[model samples]
Target: MADVTPNVSLVATPEAVSFLQNCQLPVQLNAMTGNPAHYDYDAEINTAITNLQGKAKESATLVARLTQDEVRTSPLKHQEASKLAGRLVELAEGTQRLLTSKAKGYMDASSDFMGKTFTPNPQREGYYLRAADWISREAKNGEGNGYKAIREAVTEDPDFAVAIYNTSHRLLGLPKEHAMDFAEKAVKAFAPAALDYIEKSQRLDELAKRYPAFIAQVRSSYFSPFELAKVRTYVEMPS
Candidate 1:
């Protein structure tokens, strides 16, 4: 844990406003920009993620309080409380964006020691292969087609999109979840592809039917010639 992280191990709602008052954006931003060679990349990234999650959770509690019927009846107080709650969420989101942008620097700097760490290797194209394999296995077992459920739920309950996404994010951090490992590798292998997927589609179900072709589509459309060449080299390398 970072020296600045709060010592409290929390449960239920964070009733205290100190966390909001103490949420320092500049400190969080600067923490991500340092050379990652000196730190454990996996630990540092997890810490950053946890911090963001904490802020969001705290903000959620405040949002709940603001949304309570009693608070809603008082217009000025309601507006002020809502504004403060929104600020906490905004702070968390800004920190997330800055950290993701800083990740390439950290990963690149820490590449030499990756063999000894749990951090995913960005240069490996086999990551896509792993994701393909995992998805295929999931399909066979009838566990991976939840994209339809996700889409339906997202459409029917847009207010819960963040909650659903957060559940997926938690699953990604689970210790034995190799799907996340593969996905992380694939993302670093071709982040633009992942971003494009996030921006353009929610149809993981349809794509899974022809996974290889889908992968190719993402690769060809989002990756540069040089990056494609590197991926091809990695693909053809003897494991």
Candidate 2:
């Protein structure tokens, strides 16, 4: 457990907020609005793969243009080529990571035309595979764990937490009884490390430890399509 994480205990919401504030992590109640559809994992992966393909083609063209002869002929071009080469190397690495044997299977199974949404196989889907797809299609090029990337993303933008819940609920269409099994598993599997990033709240960490199921419910209501839209407005309005 992090030194900052509270014990596996909580009081009422109001009390929890006060307790956290006393601990120096002030709890600010702010509202935001969002579109749930924006968080669908399948759609996110589809768009990423499409973009990767376009970049792969563009990289290949650049590679063709920056031939050895061209570099040898122009001293000025060598410096430009060096910078371009660095970028192409990054692109190549990302492409390689995304198209590995296992990742390629997911990519092949999940591809879609531009502007079309992709859907997961309901019966076959599991959070592990979803994490794998996320790692391949969306994690930073070198990041190995999709959930860690997801955790960072969620912490960076709480909206991502809503997306996880919404996608699991709507796109995957798992039974309500089991819909948030992933969140529960996340609580147990990742535990303290995961909570450390969530709003930097000892109270929330304790809440997750004590009531993982409730966390999903809270996120569901708090980030509902209607509520998320409001939050988006709040976020976008001028400071």
Best by TM-score: 1
Q: How far is candidate 1 from the true structure (C-alpha RMSD, Å)?
A: 26.6
For each candidate, what TM-score against the reference? Answer: 0.26, 0.20
Question: Model 1: residues >4 Å from true position, as ranges?
Answer: 1-40, 69-72, 110-239
Which one wins on lDDT?
A: 1
lDDT of every model, 2 decimals: 0.36, 0.34
What overall lDDT, based on C-alpha atoms, would model 2 receive against the true structure?
A: 0.34
As a TM-score, model 1 comes out at 0.26
Indicate the residue-level lDDT of 134 in model 2. 58
Model 1 lDDT, full chain set = 0.36
Look at candidate 1 and give me any clashing residue pairs. Answer: none
lDDT of 1 at 93: 49
Clashes of each: 0, 9
Per-residue CA lDDT of candidate 2, range 14-64, in tens? 443232232221122110111213323445433443453344235333323
